[model samples]
Target: LQQFLNASKTIDEFPNIPESSKSLLKKYLTKDVYKKLKDAKDANGFTLQQLISSGLANPDSSIGVYAGSTDSYKVFAPLLNQIISDYHQYDVNSKHTSSWDISSYNFEEFNSKHKGDYVLSTRVRIARNLSKFPLGTNITKEQRQQIENLAIQAFNSFEGELKGTYYPLGKLTEQEKKQLKEDHFLFKEGDRFLKACGCERDWPDARGIFINPSKTFLVWVNEEDQFRIISMQNGGDLKQVFERLAKAHEIINKVAQFSITENLGAITTCPTNLGTGMRASVHVKLPLLSSDEKIFKQIASKHHLDIRGIDGEHSESKGGIFDVSNKRRLGYSEAQLALDMYNGVNELIEVEKQLK
Candidate 1:
């Protein structure tokens, strides 16, 4: 711990920390805070070093830390709170609430305005963890296997569109893994951030994915979180995508008790994703807009949207395609965030139309 702290103090010896790193862990873990919280441990004995180990290892990580359990938020409040506040732009003292009401997500206006081929696909996904278990960062192999079994049990209860098959990572062949990635049905492995956090300790022992017959609806079991409930399709029918995700979540909620709190909404491994834990995003091609970086950022920020490479965070954009999604996570209702992506994308499309 002291060695990493010393390295953090010097940019040159900080390992692979990038020159452009604006990671919260790098910014907030000062000498004073480290001394104050170094000896602190959560109920599960999750130490400050364990909490920030990932950040130290993956020096370029954006958020840098992972919470071992719900108590991590309280035990490392000073550091975690600062990082969360900076990333989400939410006041640390203020509370956040979550709303999973699907009835209020009326996207008629979005549907009406969106009428073009500029948008490729829309996906809405939410991260969830089981309340009875520790997060993936600290979960045991036995716990992961149990979660996988539990997820399959819940999946068996799906009566209609949600009915799907589970593909365990351990059983997948090399070709199958390649095929899933080519189809965008699987998350890429070897993420430095996840690896550094000890989430990959058991490797493919219990990780897997669930997909419906249509491939639009899916669930990632034992990934970064316990479940990444997703609904997506080719083309800009975000309304249907959001509806499908909401329905799947409701069904799964009946079988598995998700980790959540009154203040954090849905508890996740990272503080940045604490509330809501949902990302409503779309793959959009805007040659004219993306060409002008300044205008593109200006417009996206105006609509409360964030732009990432089509392949997701820390990746480069493919062609002119970019992944655009709502910026804020916590302190907003699910319906509102969905609407933000819906309305924001529509606005982006409108701006694209006028871009020449």
Candidate 2:
């Protein structure tokens, strides 16, 4: 519960988890996992045990294992859709024609104080590891190929990429330029300017010249194209800043929308989440509780379902209720995933009808 509260607080304050944690967990987990877990708990009936037992809880193991499970994937999908939708809406609200101009706030100061560099650095490392040809060098050729396949599997496990385009200022002295280059920091320059500066790295093939009005500051990833006349003093509200960029995109495109679907039904699963897979189910003492434990166990076993005592592995409070909900899968539409969940539940219901 405390963990859930902390996660909720973080969402209220920023886009998602701090970038540092996102980088460290990227290989094992995705931003979607955090979003799912954060949104799993409800105002009624669910307990911590239910979450753990259902395999929807965030465990101490490599996030990779948890995310690899189909159960976790189901829980993450809806949340990812919501995040994308929200980002789109924020964009719509920040356009030039919109009543507000969020660019008047200072974003660089907020980023520096909040450890944005550490987060981006970690992501760069993850990308470097992923782009390698041979996944692990020590093994045989066949094993190396297998590892490479596994890396591709890992990348496919994520729904999308975290992208940003950074541009540093032009007034830096010779020593500053050298440090920036050596540090792998992003800088701005035209072809002629870069060639004259004698920097060893080639310019990024993008068409635009990178420049920031502020002499030595960073801008949000979504805001790079605006190129407005706002100062750093105008950028503190993070939501407002993101909204500005989102609005710009909406204006350029001329159409925008945000929508999400919630699956509020029971779902079945593999051995891991048998009785409570995709649904936000809560274990309760039904009126039929204690009526026929043996019969219930036998029925469940026959159909490959799980039967737990009142205090099941997924239950947090002894004899209290357990609640479990969906964890989304990356790369699939919510409707397709929902149909899968519904079909599983339908099978279980058919089994129950047979027993009756």
Candidate 3:
């Protein structure tokens, strides 16, 4: 702990950190944890923290790193898309991303091989930004409202399974809101992490959820990003869950413009969510594996997966159950990200069975 804090005074150690981010870091991070960013680089002298500052401000920020747009991506996509491909830092051909091929994914084909009661519900979501607009931090309150109004209009235009009602957070009673959250249909309060990063600027003024009658298809307005289109259910039918989101996304895109580039499909506030912006996850009990943190890390690391609490990042697992999801999002297609997670979960479930 002392070593981490001591690193703050030695910013010279991180030559990759941009000057602007260095100044910003003074306000965002304490001396502690400075070492974590020491050698983390992306492009020409671009540190990871430059792309994700919320982690320094809020400890609860899951990976504590966001994938905001790099200077290169910002030139073309502007703040609309946050595309950073450290994977090919030296030679990134395009700052723009391709349009999403929603139909390319079908979770049934990639379902977990193991079948057990250990698995609970499954969810897949994508974060998208409205094109031609600044990010949440830089936008004004009026702009936020405009984005909200546009989203409502887009959602209302939906037909078939995509049809739903928008429930503004301010309009719902406390009890009603609690019920939705209990069912995992709504997001909880914005955490300190987001508050520090400027994502909580307008609060509930333009924020809410749009849920279809079945609640299987939903969209969060002005939450973590401009939109969080989701598909989820009580069990691990990844194919059905992903299919719903893809279909709904197709419908919404017709009426709305989501920031996209040749390299990044959807723009988002966080750099980690830059590429596909898909977070496909499941709730499952991992009693045996959880008991051994080292073993758990080994297994999860081997599969490119991450473990979070049922309530999400920085929270503790309860009743021996943990939330598991993919770690990589950028530089891959939506189908690839989901497929990787499905394969990784299968591996975890099989290993859990062996431990039992």
> How accurate locally, in lDDT, is each candidate?
0.81, 0.26, 0.68
Which 10 residues in a row give candidate 1 its minimum summed lDDT?
A: 6-15
In angstroms, how far off is 106's CA in candidate 1? 3.5
lDDT of 2 by residue, 1-356 (tens): 34334223323211332334322233323445554464453232222222222122222211211111223324443432233223222221222111223233332322244322111110000001111221111112343334334423332332212122233233445686567444323333332211221111212221111223332222211111111111111322233323333333223222211111133111111112111121111232222322445654454444333333233223242332221112332223323333332233233333334544
How accurate locally is residue 344 in candidate 2, as Cα lDDT from 0 to 100? 31
Writing each residue's lDDT as its tens digit, candidate 3 over 49-151 gives 3444454554434334444333324432222221234321212455533334545544453224465676788999998888756666445678878888988
Indicate whether candidate 1 or candidate 3 has the larger lDDT. Answer: 1
Model 3 score (lDDT): 0.68
Task: Write down the TM-score of every candidate.
Answer: 0.92, 0.19, 0.76
> Better model by TM-score, 1 or 2?
1
Top lDDT hit:
1
Q: Give the TM-score of candidate 1.
A: 0.92
Off by over 4 Å in 3: 1-113
* Ranking of predictions according to lDDT: 1, 3, 2
TM-score of model 3 vs. true structure: 0.76
